[model samples]
Structures are given as C-alpha cells and as structure tokens.
Target: MRLRELLDATELGLLLLVGHDTDDTDDNDGIPPGTPLDRTISAVATNDLSDPGRFLTGGELVLTGLAWWQGDGDAESFVRVLHRAGVTALAAGEVEHGLVPHDLVRACRRHGLPLIAVRPETSFAAITEHVLRRLHRRDPGSLAGLAALVERHRRLLTDRAAPDSVLELLRHTLGFDVRVLSATGRQVAGARPPLRAKTAAALAARYLAARRAGESAPHHVTVGGRPYSLVPVPAPAPVRVPVPGPGPLPHPHPHPHPAELGDWLLVVEADTSLWATPDRELLDRTVELVADARAAREQANTARNDLADRSLALLHSDVPAEEIPLRLRSTAQAVVSGVGYWPRLQFVVAAGEWHAARPVPAAALRVLLEEALLQEDGPVPVSSEDIAATVDGDRAVLLVLVPGPSEAHPDPALDHAALERRLSAALARWLGPADSVSIGVSSPVPEPGNARRALEQAHNALRIAHAAPGQVTVRGPEDLTSHILSLLPLIPAEARRAFATRLLGPLRDHDARHRTDLLTTLETFLDCDASWTACAARLHLHVNSLRQRIARIEHLTQRDLSRLETRLDFLAALKSG
Candidate 1:
C-alpha cells in the first residue's frame, strides 16, 4: 500500500515542506534542510552525511528532513544516493528544519515521487499497523473455491480417468475451452472437433517427444492444424516398487501446466493472458487434485484385483467339474468384467520383468484380455490376461481366448521348425533380454464356460516354451497331448543339456566368474532362427563364433546338431525336463 493511501484512511492531514537549493534527494522526493513532517516517521536518517551510496534501502519510504545538506552540490549527491538505495518516498519535516524550500520541492516534483508533509505530532506507526492488519485477513470465498477443486479432482486421478472425462468436467467447472491430448499430442479427449489423421500424426511425435522430455512449460504446438496450448495433466508421482534387476529411477520434472491432485495434465486451450497470479496458484492446486484422483482410482482398482486374484487362486485348486465353470466365470466376471459382458477374453502371463511401470491399468488390462479373442485372422474366442490384474512378479502373464478355432492344427510338414520360425518372426518386434516373454497359445475355446480349460492349456504351452532355448518361446497343445511318443520324446534330456553345456559351458563358467554373455549367445541363437546370418544380424556376431558353438555342441553331444531331427530332439528334451 502506498503512503498516500495509508494516510488517507487515517483521516490525517499532512503539510507540504521542501528545502531550498538542497538537491540532496531525487525529484521523486527530495528532503532538504529544515522541513516539517507530521506523520509518525519510521527510521529517520540523513543521506548527505552517510556514504551517499548505500544509505537508503529500496523499500524503506525514507523519511528525511535534509538538515545535514545545504548546498546544491550536496543536494545533487544526496539525490543520487537515495535513488541508488531505492527509497520509496521521502517526507520532509518542517518544524525541525524550516519552511519548505522551493528547489528541493521542484526536484522532487520532477522525479515523480509522492512528496507528503506531516505535522510534527502525527504518528506513522499507527498507519503501518492498520495497513498490515488489512492484508492479513483472508477472503472466505476464495478459500471455499480452493477446497472444492481439491475434493473434485482427487477421484479423477485415482480412477485413471480418461482425458476426455476431465475435459468434460472442465467444460462445466472452469468454463473455458479444454483439450485433452495424448502424450503424442493427439486430441485423445477434448471439446474440440474431430481432427484429420495426418494432423494428429504430425503433432503426435512432437507431443510424445515433449512428454518424454518431461517438459513442464506449456508447449506451443499445432493441433488439428491450429495452434493449441498443451498443459500436461499432472501424473501422480510414479509409484515405485522394488523388484529384482535394475528398475527405472525417478526422474521428476517441474510441470508448468496446471494439474490438480493427480498426475493428469490440465491442458487449457485458451489465451495465455488468463494466467494471472491467482490463476497460477489455482493451476498448481488443481494438479495436486488430479494426482490425488489418479492415486485413489488406482488404489481402488488394485484392491478390487487383489480380491479377484485371490478368488482365482481358490478356483485353481482342485474343485468339482460342475462347480468349476461357475467358479471360473465368477472369477473372470468379478475381476475382468466389473461392468458388462466381456464376450472375448485373453489371458497373458508375464515370464519376465516387462511391466515395470504398471504397463497396463487394471481396467484397461482386463479389457485388453477380453478383446484378445476377437481377432478375425487366425483364432477367435481367445482370452487374453495381459492386463494389470495378472501382470505380477518377474514375468508378465496373459491368457487370450478367442471365439473360434476349436480344432486348429499345424500341418504335418509345418512341424516344430516351421512353427518356431513363424513364432520368432512374430515376436521379433519385442527386443531385449530384459523384456523376454513366452507366449503359449491355446486353441480357441467356447466362451461362457471354456476359459478354465483354455487357461490350463495356455499355461501348459507356456511351460513347454520356457523349456525351449530362447528368450521368447511359443507353443500349442499338440506337442504335449499327441498320443504317439514321437521321435522328439525319445531325445534324452542329458544329451540336450550336454550339448548346451559343451557349447556354452566355457562361456557359462566365464560368465559366473566375470558375468559374461556365453549363454547369451545361445539365447540369441535360438532367437535368431538358428541361422548363422540371422544370429549375426541379431547379435552382431561373426559367423566363426556361431559355428564354433554349433561344432562344440555336436562334438560334446556326439550328434549332428545341424540336422532338423537333432534340433527338434534337443528342443523336446529341453521341454520334457
């Protein structure tokens, strides 16, 4: 508050007094020798006597009766010192000095500082106290509004509310245009009209890049070929879980856009001018609210899943056949379909550390499982369980059951080799040992009752795949269920182990001693379709090293590993054990 405003409220009249030829202070307010001041002054000091350099601090409305400086030279030096020190207003007291000096008043008038005179008896302390009290009082209305925003957004974040839901809420609450963008900047949920695919694609890369960079400032990007402001919804502080192997470290970024309790971004597509000081505070609070909502919703879903998984465990134990179907359906519905009927189901199980970041939301993961069976290409009525509910421990697990393919079969010519090649081609897209996944596909089972048997079959196939020599192993039921004890069954586990032991034994010993990649070569070899060229491409290994391992395997096992029979026998033996 300005001095004038403070004095006005107190209903006190102040007299004007300026010193002559004493250019001691700037035109803003020059206090010359002998000027009377009535207001009760705080911190009275002389400028000319001091260093004239650091005498007055900027905020102190300096009260000086410039009695120390009389000459123009002294006045000029005083004015420079006061300006440098950042004094707000200078009051000249007349009773202590004399009548107002014209030169001092003119100089102060020139500089535009509020010049005020106070009678000798007026009190400045009273004025200061009054002003401070007014500022301390809080406005009830504003406080109430803040409380409401906090209460509302907490649930949204916890539920993992879609961006669209928040936009809808914004329309009714904030009364402004809101756009919810994906990490790719594509308008995932918003009031904005539909955009062209090309435009969405174009902006997606930029938005995703910015998101990955964890940009806090409102990024300026073109959306739907028009300029839009992107305010990232606040994400809840990433929940860290301790697990085996190296995990992603916390890399927090200061988010610039408004977010509430949850980690949802509150992207406002409005003019930048709306960001006033008050609004900035509101935006920050809103982010917190969003974060809260996300956390709450996630916790609720997790609790729900925990309960369902417990139920599934009970169902998995030996139970009556008649009771089995009802129990399985109940478990599926309770966990996977909290709402309407899920005609399609996919069950996915993790075999490695793939979902380190809560890769799937509980509800979404369940939905993904339900939909995995609907693919029209090869199988139908498939059930997939790759959702968040079952993605536990080191390996992520999923079971996918579709609507058809009750009796799909591999051609006699297409044996294990052809299938392995096909599976490798399909799974090559997912790279890295850290993300190794084994998929066991079961023939599609009829829905409403077949999920249990299908899940069992898929689990069996997964076990077979795990026994195979690759990071990603795939299999179906035929290999295990066939009545004929094919040549594959005749292969001895000792021979297969000996082959791997001989080929990679030296490397394993070195690895155990030095943590090396001798087994990694074998891991990559099977991943590379057992071809020298493919393995080389995958591992960047020379042909000679791969041949050496194969030769070593053959020498130690006393069998030609290059032959299809030998490879199949080895693979079966590995799985059998």
Candidate 2:
C-alpha cells in the first residue's frame, strides 16, 4: 500500500511532515499542494521502545507516541535505529507530547526517512486496522466472499454437479466468461459455444511457450478475432504410488507422476495485463479451483482404469476367445456394453521418451487417446469407447471400440486415417521439443480372437513410425496396406529419399506452392487404375475435376498417366515417400 492512500483518506487526518516541499493550501481541502508520497509501505508497526529496531522488520510505517525521545540527541539516536531497521516512514503521535518535536523531524530528514504525523483525533489503532485491511487489496468482507465462493464450488463437486454449473457460477460472480482447455484443443468446460478448435490449439501453444520461457502468466494473445488471457492451471501434484516389494516397508512414492505436457489451462476473453491486482488474484483463484476440479475428476476414474487393466489382460492372456468380449462388457467403453453387442477393437500402440523429464506414463497417453476419441458438446465426459493400459513400461496400448449403440447400428467401422490424424495431433500436445513418440494404429478386427493379429499389426506400424522422421510420427493400417511398405523400411533412408524425391519432387513442389492435393490425388488415381470415374467417386470430386487435376499433374511432372510404367513409377515413389 502507498502512504499516499493513507494521507488521501481525509478522515484519518494524517499529514506528511517531510518528504515534500509544498505550499500549505486550503484549496485542496487542508492538504498540501505538491505531490509528497513515493515509497510504498509493506506493513504497519506500532512501537514506542527506545530501541525499537529489534521489534521491527522492513518496509513498516512505524507508529509511535514519542515515549522513546527526551531531547535532540535522543531523537537522532532513535531515528538512526528506526532507519537501521529499514522502516519506510515514522508516524509519531502528538497525544503524549502535545506536538511533534522539531528535533524528530530534523533527524528523520537527516536519515532520509519519510515522516508522517498522526493527528490526535486519529487513533493509532485506526491506522493499523486500515493498513492491514488494504494489504490484501480487499477488505475482510471481500476476502470472506472469495472464501465463501470457494466453499460453494467444493460443494458443487461433492454433489456431483456438472463442471459447467460451477463455471456458470463463476461467470455470475466474476462478470466474465472463463474457459477450461486442454493442450489438445479440447474445451474441457466453459462458456457457451466454446472456443473454436483452432483457437484453443493456438492458445495452448502460447501457454506452453510461456511456461518453457519461465515467463509469468496470464499470457496474452489475440485469436478468433479477439484478445484472450490464458493462465496455466497448476500441474497436479505428483501422486506417490506404493512400491510392490517383499519388504514390509518399501520406499514410498516410488513412481510419482509429474507429467508436464498435458496441463489444464484457464482462459478469459479480456486482456489481463490491464486488470487490477484484485482481479489478478481472482484469476489465480480460478486456476486453483479449476485444478482442484480436474484432480477430483481424475481420481474418480480409478475404477475405469482398473477395468482397462483387466480388459487388456484378457486380450493378451491365453484366455478363451469368448472370454474377451465378456471382460470388455464394462463401462470403460462408451458403447452400450450390453449382452447382444459384440466388441470390435482398434489397437493403438504408443511409446515415447523424455530426455531430462519424467517418462511419459501410460495413463497419460490413455487420457490423450480419450481426448482424441470422444468430444463432448453438452457435458464433458472423460472417456468413452476407449480403454487403455500399459503392457510393458512406457508403452501404452489403447483399445477403442467402434461404438454400436444397438446391434443394428451401421457405420460401425472406425475411420483409421482420421484416427491417425487426430491421435498424432493429440500426442503433439503432450510431447516436448526433445520428446518423440511412435504411434502404431491397427486395422479394426471384428472378432475377439483376432485381437492378437491386430496387436501385431499395431506393433509393426509402430516400428515403421519409429524409423520415420519428426518428433511426433504416426503409422497406421492405411499406410501399410501395400506389401511394399513392409520392405520399404529395410532400405536405407537416404536411398528411399533420393528415389522418391527424384520421381515425385516436381509434384510435391507444385502442391506446396499451389496448396493442392495433387500428390494424394495422384496416389488415389493410381490405386484406382487411372479410372477417372472411380478416382473421382473416391475423392468426392467430379470426373472433370479429376481430369483437370490429372492434366495438371502430367504437365508438372512431364509424365504420361496413360502409360503403365509411369503409373507404377509414381506408385513406387508414393510408397517410398
């Protein structure tokens, strides 16, 4: 707090005795004309001891009754000790002496201590109470309101209230909308018509960058045609799991989780740089409250995690084929899980490494997979149609069931390519610059007995992904449909690159400059045997559109698509690339 605020409170009848040279003007309501206060007061101390240095800490506005001073020399010595104690100012009361001694003012000036005089009408108790109240930037009543608000939020969580309900309460109290977001562009909870996916992704990037730079938040950004303030929610405290050992007293918390990548974020539409101190504190409280809610939700998922463990064990163990579907009949999957429904499994095998940080936990990847699988538009659900577990250390296996609400449900096939795209994006949110993950996606299998083959396929794709470039790489069933892909990885990467780049470099460059999908179009056309009707139908384009694109491709690459050798050459290049 500033001394100026205290002096400006006219009822306090406080006067600046030193630190300013100003005319005693009545025009400013019995106050001085020039600006006087500069330094800030951290706290208020009331003392009357001759040697009050021992009683004081720094930046205190020392309140006294002149009981320690008897003469000019006494004043100088007293002031010297007060200065030594690092007090910001001295406010001597006149009740005992009937006046502030001129010697005290001279000593204070000599020691460069600002002197404030407390009028007899204002009690020292009044100044102490006032400064203490202002220290927190809010009165006790306002502080109580914040505490009460927190209590209400906790009650909401206990009652199993929706996250949005609590967020709505905050909107009413804060007079602003606050959103909760994850690193993968999923709006965990917040205001209506939640931030666009692209906007959330950009905000997450800024939040992570700010944290990596050791910069304080709320970080400011302009996205979705408006400015927003973002603050990283506190990373959940590492939970210490007991080590399983023969010893009765094993080392505690052997594997505490302190995963840094997938943090929750608090977002506000207003620019926080212009907010008041109290508002900033409120924003900080938002982070804390949101973090607490997230923790509670995660804790509630312990049962689901156990089910995943059992289900994945059944898939891997030498159990009967029929036993797998029965084990999978649980709430872990978002499907009906009814007796009539059969389970279809899509295996995702993901493994990653972190150089100087904690290893990415299998549970963390499970959470990311869930985020990639299900999106909640009404109430946020943590996981649905997704069950994941760690098979070996650091390798997470996610089992996603193609949801069939009823036995008659069509469109039950999982879109492998779309899943690859979503999952790669999701993992990017969790991997740092030095971190890399290899993700392998298996083709969906119809029967529980086929899960073993599906698992093997996933592992094969994972091996390919590990050999590929980039920190986050995904290799799925679609990428391995051809037998050539299996042998392509055995070739030297340099040879593969030289061959592909030579044949496909022109098309790649043309597509890059034009933002066209000519390369993909060319691949689809060759796969369809250059049949314009078939390629057009598969690409969701008209036959004429296909013709025009093929002509452009031929013009760019100087190759005739009608020739069998040319088509084979492009096909090989696409596979190698």
- The candidate that achieves the highest TM-score relative to the unseen native structure: 2
> 1-577, model 1: which lDDT tens digit per residue?
4444444564545543432234343443443223222222222232224343433334344545467656554444554566555555566555555644555566555554445565566544333334434423434354454346445655556556654444444432333446543322234355556445454434444443455455645666756545555555544343222333344533343222211211233455443333444444555565555445445555555644564465446546677655765666665567665534533433444243133332222322232222222222332211113233444434334443233223563111112343344324323432233333455554333343445554555566667676666755556655444412365447577775665555445545666887646456655654333545556666776777767766655664566643434544454434443
lDDT of 2 by residue, 164-244 (tens): 655654443343567887756678898767877667777776665565445566788887777888877654443222222
| Model 2 stretches astray by more than 4 angstroms | 1-140, 213-217, 234-258, 318-341, 356-359, 376-391, 404-411, 416-434, 483-577
TM-score of 2: 0.52
How well does candidate 1 score on lDDT at residue 206?
47
- Give each model's whole-structure lDDT: 0.45, 0.65
Model 1 TM-score?
Answer: 0.36
Alpha-carbon RMSD of each model = 23.7, 19.3
lDDT score for residue 327 of model 2: 55
RMSD of 2: 19.3
